[model samples]
Target: MSKGGDGKLADAAYRTVLEKILSHELPGGSVIQERKLAEAMGVSRTPMRDALGRLEGEGLLVRLTDRLLSVRVITLQDYLHSLDVRMMIEPQAAGLAVRSLTPNDISMLRSELAALEADESPQLEGRHWRFDDLLHELLAEKSGNPFLSKLIREMRRYTKIFERQTVPPRRKPGLDDHGRILDALATGRAEKARDAMAEHIRNVRKRILDGL
Candidate 1:
């Protein structure tokens, strides 16, 4: 394969491993045997190593004492700190995005959320993450600040790792929060959107803390 083809294979490996991590198929603290994983992925060990190296650099994987790689276990402090950063940034993004988000955008999000709510299959766990990703990412991308959007996306990844591993799936409450946020955004009031996003973040923190 050409150099470009090699890079593409590594990219595919990276995404596949990342999906497994986020979905908890390869839960935090589970060891990653490179040769075994490479075999399972049906790729050469070279691409798998490159993918693992990238994940390690991203803080999603760590090398333990014996030089074994494992998924990074997110600490509570890390989770809270990420949430704090999000609270500071996401509301601003939401406010800024009010004008940018079209009515069609709002309608589409509402429909997706409704579908998620109506879904009760075992696959709902995965769909929950998807919906959450779509909503936050849309707000960030529409916020008109590339820097702010980048920050939100980076912080969200860490927070989600913790949420998926430790926190139970919060379907109804989360959907309710998203609904309020959508309602606020639909009104095209920056303050309303800001307040709604802030409240949603606070509610998430409260729920997590209360359960502890």
Candidate 2:
């Protein structure tokens, strides 16, 4: 039982560490010393070691057989692949959402959209990303499939890294795309909603790849 608890602790540690890396707090390719992290996180070396091992498995961290660990750097190919997978998944999820969405779900989405539109300051762009995440979460919930929702949430993490890196310059246009998606969803048009989401995701990929 204690071992199971330790495993859960390690998993939580892995996730927190991965978030720090994605947010650039640790930055890509930064070296990670297990002993240092274990001390910093106030856990025993065993749990910290387990956490690092899990991160390496997830491709968020790379482990050297000799014991060095570093945050994984995002390559252009990685970016493209992530975009492709998101394009394939999220629009289909949106279509599912249309068939399942409740009136209350629609109302909440509208409220989030309104909040996103009202915020225009450069500093508030991070807040916009949070709202964008909420939109995706709501869509996932409306899909009425727990497993799909979990997968979407996991996939969204990669997109979050892309957004933090590329969103500021393209913030206005991104919001416009978001507005269009919300409009389609509001009308309960599944195909339109799916197409709008696909276009929005594609535009983001183009902007990122174009070095905007």
Candidate 3:
């Protein structure tokens, strides 16, 4: 394969492994045998190793005894730690993003909020997470600071992968929180947007701890 093709394959391999982990296809504590996985995935060993190494760096995989590797069983503590980081940065992110947010940005966020409200698939839990992430992603990207945006993206990635939906079909408070955040942004109240975002994150943390 050409150099570019090799790089693409490595990226594809990485995404494949990440999807498996997020979907729990490779459950926590399941061994990650690179050779076997490489053969099964029909990818080169180098790329497979690269993917595994990336996952390990992301705390999704741990190198065990004798070079063994297994998925990291995410704990409530890990969840809260990630949330704690978000609480500190993301609220300020909303405040900063206010200056940069255009009417178009507000409209786009409103549309997402509307879609989230309409989403009622009880069994398709992953759908909710995608929307939830989308809502947060907009704030992170529009927050007017590339580094902060990148940090928020990184912090939220783990939460997205480990998050489980509330079964038995309950309404997500995030839907309303997101709406309120959007409202604050629409009305050009930076501090209100900031506070709303902070409150939303706090409510999320409470839900997670209560679930635990």
Candidate 4:
């Protein structure tokens, strides 16, 4: 195959493996066998290896030995620390993003959340995660400062890995918090947006702590 074809395969492999990790299908500390994974995924070793390397570079995978790799195990402490960092940064990101985000963007996300709330299916967990991603990613991307945006995105990615380890995410509370955030942003007040975002993160931390 051409170099372009190889790159496409590698990209595909990367996304598939990353999704598995994020979805907890391959939970923390799960061993990754390159050859077996490649075979199971019906992809070439080269692409699978490349994908694993990328995930490792991103700190999602750790090299256990020269011949072994495993998913990074995020502890409860690590999750709390990540949340603390997010609490510091994401509110500021939301405040900054309020002016940049369009009405349509807010409306689209609101619609998605409403749909998820209305649906009573078992598949709601995945949709909740997707909506969460959409809301945070939009805020990060639109945050005026690129450095802040990058930090928020990275912190969120870490928190997400930790969040899915617990089955059936806190859906109702989370959706309600998101609604408050959207309402604050819609009012075009930076302070309100910041407060709403901070409260949302605090609520998340509280819910997790309460569960323990």
Q: Which candidate is the best by lDDT?
A: 1
Go through the candidates in order and give each one's C-alpha lDDT: 0.91, 0.78, 0.79, 0.88
Report the lDDT tens digits of candidate 3 across residue range 112-169.
6677677777744566666677768787887878999988987786665556422233
Instruction: Give the top-scoring candidate (TM-score).
Output: 4
What is candidate 4's lDDT per residue for 1-212, written digit by digit as tens?
A: 45687788899999999999989999998999899889988999999999999999988999999989999998888889999999999999999998888989889988998898897887888888888889998898899788888788777777888878863465455888999999998998999999999999999998888887
lDDT value for model 2: 0.78
Residue 163 in model 3: lDDT: 69
Provide TM-scores for the models.
0.92, 0.83, 0.86, 0.93
Ranking by TM-score: 4, 1, 3, 2
lDDT of 1 by residue, 1-212 (tens): 46687698899999999988878888889999889888988999899999999999988899985668999888999999999999999999999999899989999999999999999887888898899999999999999999999899888988888888897876555888999999999999999999999999999999989977
Tens digits of per-residue lDDT for model 2 on 15-115? 77877876777866789988888888888888888888887876778775577989877766666777788898889889889987877877887787787
Model 2 CA lDDT for position 119: 76
Error of 3 at 182 (Å): 1.1
lDDT of 1 at 111: 94
RMSD of 2: 2.8
Model 3 lDDT at residue 106 = 80
Using lDDT as the yardstick, the better of models 3 and 4 is 4
